[model samples]
Target: MSPLVKKSTGEFEEFDEQKLRRSLKHAGAIPSEIAKIIQQIRPLIHEGISTKRIFNHSFRLLRRYSQECARNYSLKKAIFELGPSGFLFEKYVAEVFKAKGFKVKVGVVKKGCCVKHEVDIIASRPDKTIYVECKFHNHPNRKNDVKTALYINSRFLDLKNNKANEFDEFYLVSNTLFSKDAVKYADCVGVKLLGINSSYGDDIQAIVNKYHLHPITSLQSLKKKHIHALMSREIVLAKSLLKQKKTLFELGLDEMEIKQVFSEIKNVRRSYE
Candidate 1:
């Protein structure tokens, strides 16, 4: 194995298997499977090999043995592929809320004190209305920071100031982590923040598993661009992928690719069910 490794950013850094092992474990791979993954990919590590290559190799192997772990590890990338439109993320979040028994509305527009605010996602219950601002990041290096918390909190305040009879709490939900300052400000101001890996809870992984809300990008057969194209049409879930079968061809996936994609979808559907 080479000491130096190429990062996704094109930066070279020392290889640390501990970080790799930690990531595999975090994705819910069992100890034995994690060890097997390292053993399988360990030999191919070279000084100049892109980490992407290493990851793809390991993911292929992991997907064979543990679809659950592979999909969990791919969660962020799956969400990233939903980009060019954050609305898909909002819809995904809404699905999670629906799974939890909330009546969710996406892109809800309501009047604010200073301006008209189109809230990203909203959930209503018998006793409360949950106003949500969905912040989505495409890369792991980025996080929901203090400025976002501040801006969202201000928006919450404006919404509250309005006479609109809504919302017991204002929440900012992201498929990423929050900065320390973001957490601090939210806590101080009583604004709830829900991030994928947030310490404050609303664990995205737990919610996904609970709701079986794995995104379409979890399919190993779909490439990044294919995912973005599907997402542009607001297709995010595995179920949606099956329903909008024509969208696959519209995205330019040929016959072979489409067949493979459907095959992957079948496996994914089985795992979740």
Candidate 2:
């Protein structure tokens, strides 16, 4: 019998080793490293083993093999580190859209048909204008619910009704997953949804990996205060750190720590190259 693994949500499901293999492969782990990691992990699989433990173990081992691959694997967790509040997340989302060639604005208030609404993101090009509402959750199991979909859709509707040709698209982007009802409601109302693994091809993970938009928090060397300092200076992306070496000193990192951070950032950037 397959050992049942406990999810972060307190639900238990049979462990699927193939899932782990796929994740490692996606993270750029070589065949030999994947095989070795699996060999070590198999013995540790027992009934009621938490997924968190498995992830931590795999991450530690993967980091030992390749820092780049480990950073790729940690992308989801790194995103969560962007916020206790959703402000940094909004900035990050704007950056993602900017990478896709959209002129982006964050936290802009636009007058709707009824009242003014402060949209999380406003991405525009000569062709189209997109309004995006970001739903960022620190916890993996916390999903964007139907109410969230409805709320964002209603706001979009108001804006759309105000000037139908003003915005071409409205998207609800979440750092986590969406509830089934949320997805259904979004599809029904024409509110496009983007989450960790949306049925839509342009999910958050896909976009991040495709554009090499990995956040600064992806670096394991940085502490929470370090992240805060960097973000305060509007330094969000890991690759951006390469150009701002002096900022690392401003964060109070010693010479060796700064070197280590630069090394890790280089490895992360090299992965996408």
The models' CA-based lDDT, in order, is: 0.80, 0.84
**Alpha-carbon TM-score of each model against the true structure:** 0.75, 0.77
Query: Please, what are the lDDT tens digits per residue for candidate 1 over residues 1-273?
Result: 547999988899988888888877766678999899999888898888888888778778877889666666677777776665577888888887878888988887889988889988889878778998998777766888899999998899898889874689998888778889999999999998876645565788777776668887677788878776776777778756767768788878888988888778676557666
Q: Residue pairs in steric clash, candidate 2?
A: none
Q: Could you say which candidate leads in TM-score?
A: 2
Kindly report which residue stretches of model 1 are placed more than 4 angstroms away from their true locations once superposed: 30-32, 197-200, 217-233, 240-270
lDDT of 2 by residue, 97-129 (tens): 998899998998888999999999999988898
Q: How many angstroms is residue 30 displaced in model 2 relative to the true structure, after the best TM-score fit?
A: 13
Query: For model 2, what is the error of residue 67's alpha carbon versus the real structure, in angstroms, after optimal superposition?
Result: 9.6
**Could you tell me how far off, in angstroms, the CA of residue 75 lies in candidate 2 after the best superposition?**
0.5
